[model samples]
Target: MDDDSATGVAMTRNGSTGERQLEGDYLTNAQGEDVVAGIRMTKDLSELKKEMPDLYAEFERIALLLEKHYREMQDMEFTIEKGKLWMLQTRDGKRTAQAAVRIAVEMADEGLIDRQTAVRRVKPEHVDFFLHPQFDPAALAGGKLLARGLNVSPGGAVGQVAFDANMAEAWAKNEGKAVIMVRPETKPDDVHGMLAAEGILTSRGGRTSHAALVARQFGKPAVVGASAITIDLTNREMTIGERTIHEGEWISIDGTAGVVYEGQLATMVPDIKDPWLIKLLDWADSFRTLGVWANADYPRDARRAVEYGAQGIGLCRSEHMFFETDRLPYFQKMIMADYPVERREALAALLPFQREDFAGLFRVMDGRPVIIRLIDPPLHEFLPDLVELVAELADLKIQLKHAPDMAAIDALLSDIRQKEQLRKRALSLREANPMLGLRGVRLGIYIPELTSMQVRAIFEAACMVVKEGIDVHPEVMIPLTSHVNELIRQRTVLEGEARTVMAEQGVTIGYKFGTMIELPRAALTADRIAEHAEFFSFGTNDLTQTTFGISRDDAEAGFLIEYMEGGILPANPFATLDRDGVGQLIDMAVRKGRASKPDLECGICGEHGGDPQSIALCHQLGLTYVSCSPFRVPIARLAAAHAALQETGRPHDE
Candidate 1:
């Protein structure tokens, strides 16, 4: 009715209040109702409403007819002015990727889209999303959505929604289902469910959440800040600000865009690759013949990335190897074990586990190059809290006059206290500003054994897999090194043990040693580090962290929201490469590093690996490859194509 600003196409409804339709730049409700919105066009709405009411009615008639004809959601724009109605735009409504493909393919089969259109509809990236691990779609039909947040990662999960992550993990194990991890905000503790969940859903957090980042790292589906849905733990039901559903039920979460849908909606791949992804990479490949790659975290993800045509794996975070349900207790013991002898014993027990993981990885990659980053997070991450241990031990001592497992409890408490002291010392060692802290090289320097054990595992896995007739190529990447000597030291130790092991096995297999150019210093001195290294996998996650001095985990909820909305940042730097700043660093490193060692291999292992923009940037920089999550491999390839074409054509940036 009030159509002063909106580009309303006037139509008569019983001639009571002359309603209008929305055309170019005008916002119309799903039912074509006027909501205060419009874009300026040359059409004269005042004259049209006065002169051509019948034509306007005809246009609305067509929209209704088309909706009936298609039997699905539709979006359209119409112009009605000066006694004439005009059709300006028409397309299927914006839909979930699942619905997008299904509708496209089904409609195409039903003669909606042509053969050429069908081919265009099926995006390689969309297919990758569809093929990845998903929760039991059947289970989610009973639950309801509580909130809507950014779906930074993709996958599925179902469990009794636990307010806390530990309880979520416990309930997941007890109920024998993947966890639906709910939290106001996540911390390092959620890394456990980020490990345990089939998919992750959080009440708080956003695209850069520890939950989101960890999920992306592990290739898990994650929905953050479903603030719309209210979780009531006492009654065990969630209300979507409307209807309420009880616990133990399910809700389907789409991690692509943070939308939660009702029921186990059927899923399909993307019908159309975003023209952006395709066009961007096509531009890159023309400039550089880099072999785009991906960092796969799981078997299915491995295949998905390969299907996207990634040349090889640049980084496979081997720490995720110890996150499996069967492995965490052992991992905890390995971390908390008081003596080196005990730690080594625990690590020895993990060798077979690590070997099996590598075997699976090799099987998935089918012996392709997989550069694995050794264990990264601090030891305290794997251990229980010292405060909790103290409280529990005291509680047990008080509740039971004698005590139950008092010795073990006291021992655990004592060990926790000691570890706390070590943690404090580590924190002191930690940079007051930790992105530059004693994280990467410092951790390796202080805990050389941790790196050694993992190197032994990699070599041992390589040897075993080679015996099984798989041509496995393993590479080792050291994280957070500012100076060349740090890499030289790590490489010396790795090569020495690797040589000794190879001599013992009598199988001459090759492995590459590399350092993550994640610090400004490392990138600046890449030429120096390249001297002893065979490859460089840019860990942009840390590089960006170091560059901006922003803790990705800390900024998502509080400042990033305002920063993005305020236009302080163009896009999420972690999600997309900050081409101007971080990218320049990569370019500098590549040029300088290759200058030192012409044959040195260079690629990326940051979240940017799969980002189309990052892919194009990497290609332009002449790196040998770019690596990303398996799901993003297809997007990267098409993006590579886009980049290639654009590079050669020098097309204007979109």
Candidate 2:
């Protein structure tokens, strides 16, 4: 039989000379001794029962026997040669996430495996991938391949090309078009566009780049560092070899595969509420000892996390709350203000927005703890790029020389001068290393009103929610505390402002004050720092950066990949907890802090929290919870359960 031939049945009969021969006259001229007549072929396995009843019965019996012997599903291969069936091979088959879930559930139901074995078979990444949208296989097969890059985030997206952040935002919000934001790289300033676009594509940067980090946080599809593609921002186009794609042209990207396609492709969104997935997660919850929380900054995220069975909110970066179009201007004004009163006015303007946001989150996560981190990033992040401002100022000066009249000349000069002043101020604030400079607790301490304002908002929101008969557990976290005095100073401000808010609202609500142990100093001296802290939330993203003496944003796009490939590093420290270096700090901090304050609640709120290996490490360290993005809550829950099962060597009775 030909190896490529379809599965079929061939008929034969015994001849007078004791040889197998064709039973019909149609095979009279056939050369083979076992020439067959009325051969039937089928691509379906079920069709075999009708075409070859005996063979199908034998195949089913063999399959069942193999499965029983192996104690798992068996993928068998068989061949038919000269009308005789021959078994070829049998092994465990690889499966997609959907198949994995269904098989696990069905096998447990069939008594082939217990529920614990079923849960153990399904990996956490399988659950995460099963919940997202995927490209239709047929459509993707026909798509024209443009380039491939790092699969920084998972999902399928198809949209028109957008070159600039402003244009991407406008095309998405105003024209109501799905957009893929294509850039050489993204920065903190492009967050609005990243939010507005359907997906993100960058020609430069790796997994931990700004583009990748933000894309994962927002649960958007992203392909980064496609070096084969060249982005020409000046012409608003991108080129891959001979192919040039202009703005508004259709394109499709599979972030899971890191492939860029020339045109749109069909997509299928999986049902996250699939019955089997729900049952598995419920079993996971029963087994997990460590709590799984979400790092949700908005009410919508909090609601989604709750639906995914998150216990609480672990880290809410208050700085992210200021990135909205309506809020960014006020935040920028607060950053650029020259005097105390002006800054206070800007902060006051922002207070109502913060309060309303917190109130919404509190209402959604009514009985869950919400840890709101004070404004963490450096002030320079909120300001316009100094280089862009200087370039604009120079362009205005050139236009000034070609003015049509005195009125135009005066207007151009005034604009030029104002831009020049703004450029000077931006340049003045620039630091050689802004990440290590004025950020987190340093910023809060340098300008006491910043933390003071945020604490007031948190307390005010909690008080308002409490009066509405909602139980709220608000945690005020002071970010980047390297010394006991820093925590002490911030705690004093927090308590004072919290007290003021409760008195004003005429309501009392329970709350906790904590500090993020993100620096080596903080971890080493955690005993002293814990004196003022009721809890400790490890900011491993920064801790890894600080401990490694490398900037995560820069290293990931640069030597980090080389390090991992060369075996200099076991894994990306930013993605997985460095068990020897960074992990030691976390262990030390937890032990030291708990020693000082016996009830010190410790948890991790970092990118690693969503990672399976990192979640296991957090469990091993005896942390209270692991907090990750809202979309990753289910993955974290499952991983936490796996950790518990492995440690305890048994499953919880359902």
Best by lDDT: 2
How many residue pairs of model 2 clash at the backbone? Answer: 0
Cα-based lDDT for every prediction: 0.66, 0.83
Clashes of each: 43, 0
- Angstrom error at residue 404, model 1: 9.3
TM-score per candidate: 0.62, 0.78
Model 2 TM-score? 0.78
lDDT string for model 1 (1-654, tens) is 233222343221111111223232232121234422332234443443344556545755776667556644456666433334456665556544454445444444455444334334445455455546454445445545555788788655444455666766777677677456666567765566556666677677666556766676566777888887777767766677677766555556777657676545444443224443343334333334667777876767777776656667888777777878788877777656668898888878888888777667777676578888876665555555556655665664455455457787676666656655545543434335545544666677877877787787778778877888888888888888899988888778877878877778778787788888888999998989999888998999989988998888776534654576467887778888999999999999999999999998988888888777777788788888888776666666656655665566543222
Q: What is candidate 2's lDDT per residue for 1-654, written digit by digit as tens?
A: 343222322222111111122111212112223223334222345555555567667767776777667756565666555545666677675566766777677667767787887788889867987678888878887999999999998889999999988999999999999999999998767878888999999999987677887787567899999999999999989999999999999999888889999999999987778788888888788788899999999999999999988999999989999999999989877877899999999999999999999999999999999999999988888878988997898889889889999999999988987777667777877999988889888898899998898888898899888989999999989998898998887788779889888999899888999989899999999999998999999999999999999998777655665676467886778888999999999999999989999999999999999999999999999999999988889899899989988998864344
User: Candidate 2, which segments miss by more than 4 Å at Cα?
Assistant: 1-42, 79-89, 137-264, 395-421, 651-653
